[model samples]
Target: MLILLLAAPATAQPAPVIYLDQGWSKEDREWYYQVSQGSTALSYDLFLNLEVATGQDLFRSDANSDRYGLITQAANPRNNPDGLPIGLAKTVVTEGRSKGTYVGITCAACHNTQLNFKGKRIRVDGGVGNTFDMMAYVQALDDALQATLADSAKFGRLAGRLKASSPEAKTDLRKRFEREAARVHEYRTRTLASAITWGPARIDAIAMIVNRLTATLTGIPENTSTPLAPTKPPFLWNAPQATWTQWRGVQQDPIQRNLTETMGVFLDVDLQSKSPSEGLFDSNAAISNLQQIENLLTRLAPPQWPEEVFGKIDRKKAEAGKALFISICADCHNAWPYTWTEPNKHGKRFLLVGLVPQSYVGTDKGQFDALRPYAITGQLSDQLPPPLKGEKVIPTDQLYEALQEAVLAKALSKLKLTDAQAADLHGYREFPLPPKPMAVYKAAPRDGVWATPPFLHNGSVPNLYELLLPASERTKKFYVGREFDPVKVGLDTRSGTFLLDTTLRGNSNAGHSFEDGPLGNGVIGPRLSDEQRWAIIEYLKSIPEQAGRVTPFGGPPASPAR
Candidate 1:
């Protein structure tokens, strides 16, 4: 049974409560009040603007409809008088059966917005509320397409023959099937649009194709069942609070990597690294794009908390939390600048703490695997030069440049791979943490503990209290559609949980309990006293809040010192 966290029931509006203590200086209280107010206002405005910009007709007003229509037309390649597709419009519009109507889908369709802050569950409207369920949408769409195509005697025969063939042949057949589906849908939509006078958006066409495909593939009647449920928009509030292990952090790391690697804003690209030319849109040009995003983010309204609710926070707990943070976490999980920095023994390699392990297989192989050709190839497998003589080391700068050039070359060719030699590349690269000693802006807090629920890179763990539990108690097993008993690995007494559940664990996560580390035998931290651990937690909650705009916080603003 798929165990999903149920959304909390809505409650009647209650006055906000504030909790104060002797620990809070009067000045600190005032600062909190102002910040809270500012955050609330900004959050509200930001959401409103986002809805407007995305053409979400949430209010169903005429003005909104008109605005949405105009924006949709501008962004739609089918509607464009010019032959060239502009921005993301062309790629999304031309590739699918739907001309561009599907491209106009709102961000909320995928994000699904409810999130937990502290212990309280907060719901935001207009985003894909649940991340896991997002994958189901893709599956649903694919199933629908297959069903529609199977009805044709010709297509059905082809599919049967393809499936019975070798794996390589089957792969090629599937691609052909999809291409055929796209063509059919395109013709259908064009006919419908001509009949109606107003052109149908690509999304509508795609949906029709999906419905037909689902019927063909699964032998399920499209009209016999309820339509797929809509997903809520995801919350962006306090995203910094996600645990070190959550997929959100992993997702963000890549964005940070792109920022550093390309040196500016970048579009989201597929893992296959397809469309290389398009993906490498110049970073310098991305400055304007980044600024627009930043402006929107900065203007976001702060979450509203009633004065009474704000009053309920135990100032003493928060105050002690602050001091505790400075003493313990400051060393590696820096607070002021909101970044991490640690020096190696020689101090030559300043390690950025809080980096979640990248998900690559070969990286885990001892020194031997590290030397393998596949381990270091990255995206340049096809064009990579043969191993250099004497020294196997590939200069980091050269590797970076090569990857960029290869992507550009592939983009020009519309080829997925340059050569079969490219298959060997596999290993995770370390993401450099954002520089430190920077001012605390509105980003997620890194104080180590107070942030609760949805820990890890994917928001898998529910809360800090759960994080504190010993490994055994934490190792629960459950599949996507089936329910299972929550595993008890005895983490309350131990430091880490054992990897008993194969499905829940991600790739490269084979090991003993997280508690039993140090000897390279466990998955978690060094076991600690309950008091010490909580102290660490308390310290994490005390990070100072920053109210200013986000700019680069630390490290040298100019070129690095030689």
Candidate 2:
């Protein structure tokens, strides 16, 4: 019997396993399975919620629902007038609209991977495999949505009903609807073109336009309400370090600026210049929303490893790579297991790096402008009439009063400004410099450096090997390499190999290869040899992956695919 049992099929009953708590153990697997199922469901729900919130369905008719009476309602006489329903109005009023949904194409749309025979993963990261032409997708979607919205018969019937109810209201409603529809159509066209032509710079411009337009239409502030506008699904990985309360060291003043200038409100009212007593805006509501967003983000999980796909690292190469990193890259490009005590506060700081000078320009301008409405007018909004050119200038005491009135008048449109708003926007804040020279600047902490290619803030460099070259060599006018093409560096071939003219020096705004004096100064090591450079790259590829935090209950992680 023992021999037979030993030779029994693999499916034979297994030996009894010990459990710390018998009752709990029996239910644990079921509980885990349930949790996993629940997570999957939550992920789906979050995806749909974000899709609706961001207005992504604007282009894709199949993903949209008529049940919500969105585009369909515009065709109904009771809702729309002037033979058209307002596009943005319907989108804002309608729950779950994504503004830039077409932009949020899936990862699979680009990065194609296959499981090898040995259950290993083979993935391509070149332009062929990692191509995400959002511009083309946007154009396609815009064309489709415009065609759908142009059904005149449906629009006329809706307009007729509105006119029947009230003539005056009908005209205004019709006009607003038409205007809004045109705006939406125009927005799609312009945004698609910009997304295709410009790269990172256009993102901010598009965001600004969206904020302004949304504010004008909704009567809601842009920073706070704009996120509520439809947006493309953003990547789930690398939730901005600034977003988390736990990762406080990475927090900088510019982040505060982003919250106020871009995000539309302050996370902490104390951080705002305005006092609580001054009821200029409801800081509490803004804070609550931020907290909600943070809570949601906290639960976002890392992408799951696909089944039958495992990675193998060259241990010898990795060890050598580590040495290279410590010697060559450790200064600025700090590695994992990072921890340091903050100098100012007694708090523990992690992932802190030196501040680059150029980054500060934006923050400076924002601060200067914040004081403008107050400095020029002495109030938050304009409410007073402009002083006559010849009118006696008010005394210093009365100047404050005059400014306050001006702010109120400006708010009410009672006052008109003679000059454009001040342009003293501040740049990003500076952090403590690293002890030694590091290869890169402004590179944020991510999963393994190797797996995440197209390195650098703007993703100017493609791989670690290219980045290993000293600034002197890499900064040459026409220098080219396997991945670091001059064209991609925002330069024409005639501009020579160096993306930026390091020879001309002093903030030329051509490429990023300026002298490392203020931002890039500090010597940690000598230039690397070709073999050493490749070895470092190999080491970077070998670093263990860090676990990402799971998306929370309300803020579920986005789908792995899209």
Candidate 3:
């Protein structure tokens, strides 16, 4: 029998020895900016219709007329202008029968965002993109494509752009477009029915992955949809050394983790029908892209606090805040000691990874439960249309486990990842990592927490100022997608146009309080006055400035002190 461990909510992890200044070289910052601004890991191009039967670009000419896509553009580190949105890179279908170069979205879409404070733009490379609305983008794409297809003039304009040869060709193109449009529409319709509505910056990422594997790819008979367990996509500055990733620590291998994410983006690994001219699949190319991106991100360092924009830090206040942080939040937010072994070419990097107990973090429970080994979250919704529902529920984790044990080719066939034209999309990894069920989240090295606001795993709270407030004083719902508020040290809650309702399933902001408690006390941390909380925030903002300092935990320097 395959071993799938369904772990209970574990306790908080021990703190790792962290330095006040994380030792990142200048080269690391340059590499990180490239990784941030470039690289898509071979996009699924969900924003574009990349899967049409004919190799035709039937998209509206004004596809990018709206300069900003889903979210606003921030400072461009490299200033490469191809008339594309930030974080979206341009790539071509090099080996496919359907030959065309297209722009694709990348990791930066969700990980990189801007904070506009008083007309000054502050670009936070690995920060929470709290303004992005992913679900809405998908739905809007569906609506726009459908609308474009229905209008005769619009269809004519698109046909002219495609340069269709004859009436018959145009007819064939329209039919092909209709088919592709329906595919997207069906996907949108099915996913929308789970009663899952995500506010800006939050998504049911795990659910999107599972749903693709079970319902969209496999065509599960039961049609049980995955639950909408939305959480904030994690920052990448400290990700290279993370013991595990995803809020629940579901992903361990960086290569596999990134591969699974590309699949979520709709990387076309397989063709529905074999294109005799173009061969079946591009496994090597796809894997190479993932590898390239993984390597690029390895050098990533967190965005430094912009003292120029935010103004010089109050050294006195910051120093006091650093002490307060060490005393109050270090238990869970502390960083670990990381080192590369000597003769590092063949030696692996090592970190004393500290894992946070999931059950103890008081923010939200919805995202934590996603990896419940025995829990069945992808059952067909009773609310789904009669034809799609009423079938026996197929346990999501069980089904995935069964598939994992099967032959790779055979499993791909079962999962609809392989087609007559293509044998497999590259089954290097399964959707959910073979279930070594972890029940805790990470204490997540507080390396770059300052820029990553809307704090907590689910992004339930907006900023440090609000986060430090008692739960009762926290706003239940507030607008997102506004400019940064420099004074508040968070997104401008006042001008937020998107209402993020915490009452939603995965958006509970009721945990991570810092009052009336101490280290090791289950949910809450040490008590702190408002001034102290601001001090801690000050320390966080100044993390990059404190480079080459004595290590926290009061010990001799490790590894020759950088």
Clashing pairs in 3: 44-266, 223-380, 224-378, 224-379, 224-380, 274-421, 358-440, 362-511
Question: Candidates 2 and 3: which is better by TM-score?
Answer: 3
User: Best by TM-score, which number?
Assistant: 3
RMSD of 3: 11.9
Where is model 1 more than 4 Å wrong at Cα?
1-113, 116-132, 151-311, 323-328, 337-405, 408-452, 458-460, 478-504, 507-562
Worst 10 residues of 3 by lDDT: 13-22
Can you give the lDDT of residue 346 in candidate 1? 21
How do the candidates rank by TM-score, highest first? 3, 2, 1
Displacement of residue 83 (Cα, Å) in model 2 is 30
Task: Tell me the whole-model lDDT of each prediction, alpha carbons only.
Answer: 0.28, 0.29, 0.53
Candidate 3: stretches off by over 4 Å: 1-82, 94-103, 192-194, 269-285, 336-346, 370-394, 401-437, 517-522, 546-562
Q: Tens-digit lDDT track for model 3 on 416-515?
A: 4334222112212223444654567666667567777677788878788777766667889877765676555776778766788888777788766655
> lDDT per residue, candidate 2, 426-447, as tens digits?
1111334223221222433333
Top candidate by lDDT: 3
